[model samples]
Target: MGHTTGGPDSAKRRLRRELLAVRNALPADDLREAAAALARHALDLPELAGASTVAAYVSVGGEPGTLALLEALRARGVRVLLPALLPDDDLDWGAYEGEGSLARVRHGGRMALFEPSGERLGPDAVTDADVVLLPGLAVDARGMRLGRGGGSYDRVLARLARSGSRASLVVLLYDGEVVERVPEEPHDAPVHAVVTPSGVRRFS
Candidate 1:
């Protein structure tokens, strides 16, 4: 008998299992209330309020609320850019004008909403952005994030680092998803802060 080798698929299964367990454990009503509070706090933050352009992720799976926050940001005249998954597995950002510009992209067993536009931005775009909200399965108090086994955000954040920009990395999560630690790899990028349904927490 031979032991099964744990490769990419195995890692993905582990991540999927963890996320599923966390989602199942989340308190539905409390999470919703916390999401509303977090949205209010994010909107009122000086960084978010003053930002001319912001990059935010399109949440998938059972992640907590973000639609309301995105709408609120748009209403405040902030230029919102969303990540569009490209064929090469890199992200191409596009302007999010409103609900009118949204189109469907199939992903993760269902369709994901995306904004498709020819406009593309580089790492300097991060320097220009005052705030950027990152998507994650789990985030720790020290700012380390555990993503869905994909290296997309890590690659993008690395580009920002090479450009010497200090854009805020805000990870949106459900309240309990904020934990003491998460399994991390060498290439993983750290977040600056975390936003839960309750409020925003700054991590060192």
Candidate 2:
């Protein structure tokens, strides 16, 4: 009934709508529990093990929470870099000090985002990360991630590619967000793994 096919863009649009519905339908209590479970599972990721610096983002809306994970990584002495949205939809990086180090910023007519308030490093700083945590709406069996229509992370991926970064790219999502398939384009690159509250999935 919804966009079943047509082209990649249409397919993505339909999937986004469907996933958002599922995400927004989560109960507050359930979301809180999921957040804690997500941190526990994500902390067990091999990609994050022994990493000195990890690039991450703050979860907003009903997105799988990363605040706990960030704190855990910091406590482990991992340098956590968070993304700060720029006017051109690219990201600027900043160090995560703690929970109080974040600031809520509303860009134009968009919903507010929790961003690091520390000194900003240029977007290229992400290239130095040993691991990069990505936020997504869905990830397929092949490791391709379906993000919100914003195209922000698309630029981040492009930047990493252009720099020849070897950082392990990981996506944090709820268990149900992992799917059998997702629409993709030629520019789409597979992630190394996906971490859900239930467990972790890796691709070859």
Candidate 3:
């Protein structure tokens, strides 16, 4: 829940379902192609180029792939922090070493997730990141993100706010996921930009 689905959140609930259907309906081949294109566009972002640490998550199901970009970031000597979902829907961070550094974890009612297995750096680890790559169904011109309704990333964003972190918030999505407007609430914090298969759009 990237600042989503709790405050003025009902409208987003319907919108999330609609956007999710469109994303989940893509052909296997199209999903693959979009992942590659998305990686290409994302890797070119200036925010990521010189970032020492980035908080990111693995792409699962119909979500746009981030494996390529993860590998590229690791190869650049960047510190990549991935989230391990907690029972309370909050997140704990861990350093992503490589493909071998990940372990498969399955939470009840959730698909298996590939998480960093070495050590747990605590939830506050995200505050130290230079950029935080968020997962979302859609991003509006206002940079408001519609999350998966779990509220995991919502806690992440809230934690960052409490600590007054300066990390650049970014969302990775498919080309069509960028939209005109999205429901927003008091808890919603606008993202800095969005990266898609087509290109990157920054918001003030």
Candidate 4:
């Protein structure tokens, strides 16, 4: 048999499982309060403060909450764009109107996600964002983010690069999710900053 349990890929998988277990163990009340605090800290970032448009996602299950941040941006007159998962795992964009505008969608055998229910703005819409908030399980000291392994955001990053977008990329996570290091691949790109319930950390 060939070896399949080594290298950065396997390390990422192991770390993701461990992080998820801790997240899932959190109390509902704790998660709710963390969500509120996460929003407050994220809104204070200069990257989001003067942004005309933001591309973000609706957190699901044990992931760090983003609904509060979404509403705050909308109220600030920032055009909030939420992702709609495509069959190919690519993401399409849509305007986030509010709580009423999101539809719960289940992608194949994956968990149900709250996505925008309005008109599809196409994937290219993300290029217009001044900031893009990524949902991640963890961020390392070097600002490498560990995503859900859906490859959706990878495509988004590629698109941004192809289009020469200057959008500041940020990740939202719990305080404990900020660790000393996370496994990284050659294609992986480091984020500009991370927003946790406790505060924000930026990388050069």
Local distance difference test, each candidate = 0.74, 0.92, 0.91, 0.94
How good is model 4 by TM-score?
0.97
Lowest summed lDDT across 10 adjacent residues in model 3 is found at 1-10
What clash count goes with each model? 2, 0, 1, 0
Residue 29 accuracy (lDDT) in model 4: 98
* Candidate 2: clashing pairs of residues: none
Candidate 4: what lDDT?
0.94
Estimate the overall C-alpha local distance difference test score of candidate 1. Answer: 0.74
lDDT (tens digit, per residue) of candidate 2 on 1-204: 664548989989988999999999999898898889989988898778879999998898899988889999999999999999999999999999999999999999999999999999999999999999999999999999998979999999999999999999999998888999999999999999998888888988
- When sorted by lDDT, best at the front, the candidate numbers are 4, 2, 3, 1
**RMSD for each model, in Å, please?**
3.8, 1.5, 4.2, 2.3
Candidate 1 runs further than 4 Å off: 1-16, 24-34, 107-113, 117-127
Local accuracy of candidate 4 as per-residue lDDT tens digits, 1-204: 876668998899999899989989999999999999999999999999999999999999988899999999999999999999999999999999999999999999999999999999999999999999998889899999898888999999999999999999999999898999999999999999999999999999
How displaced is residue 182 in candidate 3, in Å? 0.9
Q: Which stretches of candidate 2 lie over 4 Å from their true place?
A: 1-5
* Per-residue error (Å), model 4, residue 180: 1.0
Scanning candidate 4 in windows of ten residues, the lowest lDDT window is 1-10
Please identify which of the two predictions, 2 or 3, would achieve the higher TM-score against the true structure: 2
Q: Which residue pairs show backbone clashes in model 4?
A: none
Query: Residue 106: error of model 3 in Å?
Result: 1.1
**lDDT tens digits, residues 49-104, model 1?**
67888888655546766767888999989988888776655677877777666666
